[model samples]
Target chain A: MPVEDLYPSRNRTEPAILDRQDPIIHSTDFSAAPISEEQLRQYEEKGFLLLPEVFSRAEVSRFLNELNQMQQDQALLDSEVSITEPDSGALRSVFQIHHHNDLFSQVASDPRVADIARFILDDDLYIHQSRLNFKPGFNGREFYWHSDFETWHVEDGMPRMRALSASILLTDNSDFNGSLMVMPGSHRKYVSCAGETPDDYYRHSLQQQTVGTPDNHSLSYLHKQYGLESTAAPAGSVLLFDCNLMHGSNGNITPMPRSNLFFVYNAASNRCVAPFCNQPPRPEFLATRETFDILPQRSASQDRKAG
Target chain B: MPVEDLYPSRNRTEPAILDRQDPIIHSTDFSAAPISEEQLRQYEEKGFLLLPEVFSRAEVSRFLNELNQMQQDQALLDSEVSITEPDSGALRSVFQIHHHNDLFSQVASDPRVADIARFILDDDLYIHQSRLNFKPGFNGREFYWHSDFETWHVEDGMPRMRALSASILLTDNSDFNGSLMVMPGSHRKYVSCAGETPDDYYRHSLQQQTVGTPDNHSLSYLHKQYGLESTAAPAGSVLLFDCNLMHGSNGNITPMPRSNLFFVYNAASNRCVAPFCNQPPRPEFLATRETFDILPQRSASQDRKAG
Candidate 1:
C-alpha cells in the first residue's frame, strides 16, 4: 500500500481544514516522563506547554554570551546559516546551532530539555532543526500566522505530526514585545494552506514568508474558535508546542528585544523522505534529514537533578 | 556486491599517497561531445582545460550587474550564503547561486558549459555545488592548498572521483591578481591529508580551512613533480578542473578585484551517502546530495549556438 499522507498541504487552489489523524502524544506510558500529569493535560488540551524558569539565569546568561560571541564573529555572521533582518540588517536567526557551536549542542542535550522532548515524542528523538532567533528592539519584523507543519511537510517531506518545537527564552518575553503567539488547541486540526510551494521557498521565507501561508479566512476561523495567546515569560522559560499548532508573532515595537534558542525535535522513526509537494527537500539546516538519538542510553531521570 | 570504498582518506592516523583508481572520462561515446578532440586529450593529460572567451563580454557584464545587485541588497548580503572576507567583511562568496538566482541557473544549464561537463563525465549530471567566489582587491584572503575530493569524500560522502568544477571568470584575472592556481597533471594522485575532519568544518573552513589540508611535504612533492600553473585570462573565460586536482590561490594584493561564478558538476550515480569520516554530512549548499539528470533530452550540440 502507498504510504498514507496523513496531512496533505500546499500546492492547492483553496485552503483546507482537516482533522488531525495522528495522536497528539504517541507515548502510551509516562512512567519516566519529565513533565507533570497536569502539564501533559494542559499540553494535550491547548497544544502547548510552558515551563517557567526551567533554566537558571546563569545558564541563560551563558547562552547569551555564546550568542553574542557568534554575532560578533563576522566570519560566522557572514555564513549562509546566519540570517539578518531585511531592513536594519540586525541578526535575526542563526541556524544549526547544535552542530555549529559546542555550547548550544550541550544546551540541546541537557536532560532538563531533552527529557521533556523524549516524553512528548515517545520515541528516540533527533534534532530536525535547531536555531537561535533574535528580535532586535524596534527593528524586529513580524512573522505572519501559519502552521510550521504545512511548510515542513510540503517542502521538507516530514511524514507525520510526530514533531514538536522547544523554545528557550534568552530574554524576558513580555506582552508588548514580540513573544510567540499560538492559537489555543490549534494542533487538533491541520490547515492545508493554499498556493504551490515554489522551489527554494526557504531562501526568501527565512526572512519573510510570502508562500505556504494560512489564508485570512482560516486564520480568522482559528482565531475566533480557539482564541490567540501570546507568551509573556521571564528569561530561562521553555515553551513547547505541537508541530501543527497555529502560531505566529508580532513585530517588536518595544524598546526591549526578545531572543530564544529554538530546537525542533522529531521522532527518529518519522524522518523525512522526498518532499510531499514533489519539490527538492530543503537544506539540512532548515529541516534536518539525519536521524540519531540525541540522548543515547540515558534515562529521563538520570540527569534531572544535574541539569 | 558491497560497494568498494575507494579513495578513503580521513580517520587514518597519518597521510598516504594513492594512485588514481578511476578513469578521467566516464562517457565512452563522443559522437555528440561538445569539446574538441584536442581539448579532451589535454584534459585527460593535465586534469584541467581552460577555454578562453567562452562567454561574450556583454554576457559577463550582465552577470556582474546581477552580482552587484545581490551584494547591495543588505538582506542578501546578510544571509549565511553570502560569505565575506574575515578581516574586511567585504563580500567574498555566495553559495547556491543556481538555486538562489534564475539567471545563474540558465548559465549553468547553458549548452556551452553543461556540454563540456557532459562530454567529460560521460554521464547524466547534477549540481554538486554552486557558488560565486569574489576576491575584492586587497581584502580577499588566500585559499590554502587542498584537494576538494579529500573534503568531499570525507565530509560530504561523494562516492567516487567523477566530479569536476567549472569556474566562469567575471573579471580579468591578471598574473598579480588572485586567480586560481593548479598543479598540472596532479589529479592522478590522491593526498590523504592528516587530522580528523571536525564537525561543521565548513563553518570555519569557509573563511579559512584549518583542517583537511595537505601537509607541506605532500605539497612540495606535487609542486616538484607537476609544477604549478595559474590561470591568466580575460572576462568570459572558463576554467574546468578535476575534483582530485591539487589547487589553491594567493590572496589578492592588487587593486583589481577578482570574481567568478563557480559550479561543480558530478555524475548522478556518484551521489552522497553517509560521510566517509563518520561525521554528519555538510549542508546541501556546500556539497549537494541530490541526484537528477540535468539536460535530460537535448543533445550537447543542440544548444551550442543558442548559448
Candidate 2:
C-alpha cells in the first residue's frame, strides 16, 4: 500500500472536521494538568490545541539561562550549528540539543507533552525529530506557508499524520515578533505537496518554507478553503499542531525576539519506513528512531525532596 | 585586559603532569565500569584516554537504528545542517544534537562522562557543546589539524584550558577509516592560533578545522616534538581528549566508516565572559552557558526498577 493510502486525495472534496478532545488550557504548571476528554476533542476538531502558560516565569527564566549559556559557553560557540543569518549571524535553529543538555532532554520527554501525544497517537511514542526555532528580534525570518507532513512524509518516510509537533515557547511571541499562522482546519486536505533541493546552509525545506513553499495553485486553493489563524502567545505556552496542518510564520521586524523549543512525537508503529523522495532523511540529532519511556512525572513535593 | 591575561604564555616553562583518578571504564553496560586511579595517570601523561567497548552490540544496534532513522526522518535530513560534500549531499557533521534525541541525551550526560569531567576539572560541569562527526565510508573528508581552544579562547571568550571532549565511537574506527590523530600532551601550549570564516555549507571554522588548520610553523613544531597517535577502536570505544590538544583526521578513502559522538564538557565556572575575536560568538546551540545539575547516577537495578 502507498504511504498515503489512507488519506483522502488532494482532489477529494469536503475535508472532514476530524473530532478530538478540548485543549487542556493550563496555567504555569502542566505536569499537574489532568488529561481530560475535552482536550482530545480539541485535538480532533482544530487539528491543533493550545495549552497556555504551561510554565511559570521562574521556569522560563531558567530556560533562558540555559539558552543564552550555550551561546556564551566557549566550547559550544566553536561548534558548527545552524546560524540563519551569516551576516548578522544570529541563530535560526539548533538541532539535536536534547542529546547534550539535561533541560532539553527532560522537557522533550515531559509527562504533559507525552501524555498529550499518547492520547493523540494511541501508541508508544518516539521522538520523530526536534529543534529550537529562533526569531531573534529584527533578525527572525519568515517561515513560508507550508504543511510539515509534506516534508515529513516525502523526506522522513513518515507514513501518516499520526504524529504531532508541540512547541514550548521560550520567549514571548508578540504580534510584532513573528508568530505561527495556520490555516484553520487545513489538516483534512492531504496535499501531495512539492519538494526542493536542500538549502546551501541548513538543507531545510518547508514544502512551504524557503524554496518550495506553496505554489500559486496550492496557495489559492488553501486560501479559498480556510482562513489563516495566528498564534501570538506569551512565553511558556505549549502549542501543539497536527502533522498535516498548513502553517507558517511571518518575519519579526520588531525589536522583540520570539523563540520556541519544539518536540515532534511520533507513533512507534508509524516509524519511517522509507524515504518517499530520492534523497535520505536528515541527521539523527534532528530525527531519532529510538522510543524511550517518559519518566514518571515528579510532583512538586517529590521534586523538592529530590532537590 | 586581553583574554590571555589569565593564562600562562605559550612559553610557559613547565607542563604539569596533572594527575587524578583512574578511568571508570565500563563495557556495554555503563554501570559496570569501575573508576580506577590508574586511568587518571594515563590522562595526565597522554592528554587523551580510551574507554574500550563501553557499549554492547545490542546497544550499538539501537544506536544504529537511531542514526539511520535520522537520515530517513525527512524533517531532520531536510534541516539546515552542515554537510561535508554538497555534491554528494552526505551529512558531514551534525551540531547541537544534545537538544533533540533521548538516547543521545542520556548517553551525553551518562554518569560515566560527568564523573570524568568532575574529576578532571575539580568542579561542577556544564556541557560546552556536542556534535556527531560522521565519516560515512567514501564521503568522509579530512579534519585538518588544529587545537580546539584556539577557537574557543579567541572567538568564544574561553579564559583557560579547563575543558575536555569525549568521543563515543558509533562505528568501528578501523585503521582504514578516518580516525582521530592526536599529538599527546599538546594541550600545554596555549597557542594564539588563527581563525577563519565558516564554510558556505557548514557555517563553521576551528580557528583551524574549517579555516586555518595549522601553518607550517605550528605543524612542523608539533611534528618535531610529538608523534601522531590514532584512535582506531571499535564502535563502542570512547576517546576522550583535552580541548587544547592539537588534533585532526584524514579522509576515509577505504570502505570503512569512522563516525563518533563528541561531547565537550566545561567547568561551570569557566562560562564564556565575552567574545575575544572581531566577530561575535557562533549560535547558542554551539556554545551554552547554563550550568545544569547532574542527575544522580541510575544504577542497573534502579533502571530495572524504574522500568
Candidate 3:
C-alpha cells in the first residue's frame, strides 16, 4: 500500500502534533531550563551543535580503559570481523564494548546529555540505541556524508520531532583527526541518498568502497548551497544534530586512535523496529521504569565488585 | 572489538551449521527433497518448518481485500508496500499483510514459505516477521497473543530464538470482533494476581491495557516465565512459536472479519540482538545477481518516461 493511505488523513500542512515546541537553550555552562530559542534556531539553520565539556575526563578515560580490556578479552576468544562478501554498500566495524556496559548506561542517563536531547527533540527523550565508534589508528574507513534521519527514514519515517543523535568525542578531534564535517541547513532539505545512482566518485569505487565513502561533489554542492560547516571539538565535547541533518566524518588520519560514543534518542512514543531477534523491546524502549529497576545501577560499591 | 566480546564466554563448541547434505528447497512449487532427516528432527523438536509457496488466488484476495481502496491504489504507486513509521508498532500491523499477498515480490520470489528458512535455520519453523501481518481492516486493530523464545548460546553470545508468531487470517480483524488471545504462558504459576496485570482471556477491551493493569497478570507472568504462544490458523496458515515452546492463543471468538495467509521462517543468523544498521557483509550473506539489476531496471524505466 502507498505509505500515505496507511495513515489517516489530516492536515498534512500543519506540522504533526507530535512535533514538540522549540527547546529553551541554556547558557554555555550547559545549565539552563532547556534549549533556548537561539540554540534551536541555530540548530535548524546549521544542522548541528557542539555542547562543550559534556563528559568528564575521568569518565572518558574509564570508558576507554573498559573498552581496551574488552578488546583483549575478545581477541582471546578468537573473534574476527568480516565485511559483507558480495557488498551491499554498507559499512562495518566492531567495538570491544557492548551496548549493555555500565558506562553506556551512565551515558544514556546523563542529565546533561539528556537535557541537550530534550532541547533538540523538544520532548522527553528515550534512548534508541548506543554504540562506541572505534577507528583504530590504521583503519582507512571514512563515514559517508549523509543525514542520520535519511537513513532512519528508510527504517523509521519523516519529520520526527523526537529523534536526534549525540556524538561525544572521546579524543580531541580536528581536520587531521577526522572530526565530523556537516552540510549546514542541508538537514532542512531532508534528502534521501540511499539507493540513488551514485555519481562518478561513488560508481568508480563500487567494488571496493562501502556505504560511508565520501562523495565530494555531493558534499561540496551541499556546502556551497547551504553554507555547510565542519565540527572540531575537544575530547569531552558532545555534538547534537537532528537525525535528518546531513553529516559524516573523514577517515582517521591522526596517529592516535579516534573514538566517539554515539547515543541515539527518540521521543517516548516512537515505536521501535523489532531488532534482528524476536520482538525484544528497543534498547531505549526497554528503559521503562519497570525495566530500569532490573538494570544494575552504578553504585559506589560497583568498583569493589569489579575488583 | 570482535562480536564475541559482546557476550560472556561459554564452553567451546563447534558452530551450529546447517547440514550440507540436505536437499535445497526452492520457492517455486514448495517442492524440495523430502524434509531431510536432520530437518525433520529440528522441526519436530523446534515446532516449525520453512516451506516456500507459490502465490495462489486465496492468498492474494485475502490480503488485497483487507486494504482500503486508497491503500490499494497506493500499492500501484510502487509495486511494494512502504512502511514509513518504523517506531510505531502499528505500521507492522498495516504492512505485514503484503507478505501474505501472492502478488507481492517477496512472496513471489520464494514460495516455499517456511521450508528454506527452516533448512538454513535448522530449527522448527516459526514466522519471525511475516511481512503480511500488517494489513488493517476498515476499523483497524487485529490479533493479540502471548509468546516467548527458546534460548541458546552461540559463539556470538546467548542467542534467544524462542518464540515465533503467525498471521493465519488475512481478512479484516476488528477490535469489536474477537482477536487472538494468549494466556501469557504459565500465568497460573504466579501466586498473586496483582493490579494492572494482563488477563489470560482474550478480550478486545483489554487490548490497550498496560503492564500493571489487573488484566495484565497473564502477560506479566508469561513475560516472567518467558513463554507465550498463539495457535490461530486458517486455510493458508502462519504460526510462530518460541524456541522454549510456551505459548497459546485465544480462539477467534469475534465475528467482525478474518482471513489467513501464513509465513514461517527462522532466524538466518544466530545473534539475538538488533542487527547492526551497517553490519559488514559476510560471505554467507545471500544476494542473487538479480538483486543489483532490480534497481537499475527501475532507474531505466524512470529515464524512459522522462525522455
Candidate 4:
C-alpha cells in the first residue's frame, strides 16, 4: 500500500494541525562527534542547535571566493538553477551546488558536516537538496514563515520528518543583517497550509513562495505558543534545524550582507513517494529522489578539524 | 537489497552484451483498443509497430501550432529546457512538454495514446520523460546508435525493459527526412557501451551524445544479425517500440523538416533508484525522478475518436 500522507498541507480548503508522525533520530551510532546529552536535550526542546566558529577564517575566505566567482560569471548567473532577488535583481540563491561545484560537493561529504547529520538522522542519508543563499544588503528579500516538510511532503513526496538542514554561514549574520529566526518547539506540530499549488510552481516559488507558506492564524498560534528566536552569529558557524521547524528570515536593510551554504540531508529509508497533494513532483534540484546510496562518512582528520 | 545493475552500460571498463532481463509486455488489460494477435506477433518479432495516421489532420495541425508557438517565444527558447542544434543554433529539442503545455498533458493522458501503453506494459504507468524533437531542414544533426534503455538504466536508474517510446509524428517523415531507424530484433540483446558518464553529461549528451553511443563492434554485430529498417511514415502516425531497441537516425539534409512528439512511459513498479554508474542522476527534464503518479486513462470519446 502507498504510504499515507499523515500531514497534508497544500491544495486544501482549510488548514489543520497534527502530531509529527516520525522520529527525530533513527540511529544510535555515535562513532563521530555526537552531541552531548545536554546539547541533545536542547535540540529536542528547541528544534534547532547553533554551533559557533565551526570553520576557520581561511576556509570561510575560500568559500567566499568560490561563491563570488560563481555569482560574477554571467553564464552561471543566467542558468535556471540560479534565482535572483525579485526586487533588486541581485543573486539570491543557487540550487544544487553539491552537484554543480567540486568544492561544495566536498563540503557536503565532509565528516564535520555529514557526521553530525548522520548522528541526528541516525541512518544512511542522501542529499535531498543543496543551495547557496545570498542576501544582499539594502534590497535583500525576506523569506516567509513555513515548515520545509510542509512543502516537501506536499510537492516533493518526502515521507517523514527525518531530514535536517545544515547551514554554514559564509558571512557574519548580525541582528540587523537578516539572521534566521525560528519558532521554538514548532517542529513538534505539523501545520497544514491552504491554497492549491499551481503547475510548475517551483519556477516562481523558488523566487518567492506564496502557496506553501503558513497562514496568519497558524503563524500567530505558533508565535504565541513559542516565541521566535533569532540567531546572530559570526561567519563559520553552523545552524542545524529539524525539517518541520517553522523558520524564516528578515530582509537585510543593513550594510552587512548575509550568505550561507545550506545542505539538507534526508534518511535513506525516508525516500520520497508520489506527492501527497497529488500534484506533480518538484524538480530534482529541489528534492532529490534519484539517489539512495548511504553516505559513507569521511574520516574527520582528513579535513580541517573543528575549532 | 538494492537492485543490481543488470545492464550496466556507461562508466565501465568494456562493453558486454546480456540477455534482456525483463518482460516486453507487462499487462493483459484489453479494455481499451488492444493490438490484434498478428500485430502483437509482429511487435514481438520486430520490436516495433508503426500505426498509420492514428490522429486526424486537425489534431496534427494543432500540435504543430503549439510547437511553433513554443519555438517562436524567445523567452521559452532561452530557457534551459530548450536545447539548440550545435551547428545550426536552431531549436533542436524542448523537454517536459507534458508539464509545460496544457494541450500536451491532455494528449499524454488520452486513451488513444496511453491505453496502448497500459496494455503493453500491463501495469500502471508514469511518464519517465517527454520531449519535442525538431530536425530542421538542412542542418539537423544525427543522433548516434544506442538503446534508450541503456542510457535510462545507467543514468536514470530504470531497472527493467518494461518501458516503451511513443513517437507521434508532427510532420511527414520521408526516406530522406531523418526518420528513426531501428535494428529489427535487437531489443532482445542489451548492449553495454564503453565509456564513463562524465558529471553533468546530459548538458552535452542531449545536443550531441558522444559518451554513451554503442561501439562499432556492437552496432556491426546487431546490423549483421538484424538489418536496420527506417520508419518512413506520414504525419499523425504513431511509432511504438521497446526501450532496448537499437535505434538512431541520420542527419536531415533534405529541405523538409521532421518533428515528433516523444513520450517515454515506464511501469509504476519500475520507478528509478540511484544511477547505475554511481554518478549524480541527470536533472528532471532529462530523466524524471519525481512524481510517479499513475497516468489516469482518459475516456476515449472525450477526445477525438481515433481516426
Candidate 4: residue B169 lDDT (0-100)? 97
- Supply candidate 4's per-residue lDDT for B241: 94
Error of 1 at A209 (Å): 0.7
Q: After superposing candidate 1, which stretches have Cα over 4 Å from the reference?
A: A290-307, B1-307
Q: Which stretches of candidate 2 lie above 4 Å from their native place?
A: A1-307, B1-34, B81-84, B194-212, B290-307
lDDT of 3 by residue, A194-223 (tens): 233233322233224433322344454555
Cα deviation of A39, candidate 2, in Å: 79
Q: What is the DockQ of candidate 3?
A: 0.01
lDDT string, candidate 2, A78-115, tens digits: 55444455556666677666667788888777766766
Tell me the deviation in Å of residue B268 in model 1: 81
Q: Write the per-residue lDDT of candidate 4 for residues B1-307, one digit (tens) a residue.
A: 8898778786577887779977776655433436666666677788898988888899999999999899899988999889998866899999988878899987888787787787788888899999999997544566667799988998899998989999999999864455887888999999887889888888888887878887766776787788667688999999999999988775543346899999999988889999898688888888877755678877667554432
C-alpha TM-score for every candidate: 0.49, 0.44, 0.37, 0.49
lDDT, residue B260, candidate 1: 96
* Per-residue lDDT over A1-307 for candidate 1, one digit per residue giving the tens place of the 0 to 100 score: 4456777877678988999988888877766566777788888899998888888888889999998898899998899999988877889999999887999988787778777777888988888889999987534566767788888888888889999999999999864455777888989988888778777888989988978877767776776788767677899999989999988765553335799999988888888878888678888788887634454535445436422
lDDT for B304 (candidate 2)? 22
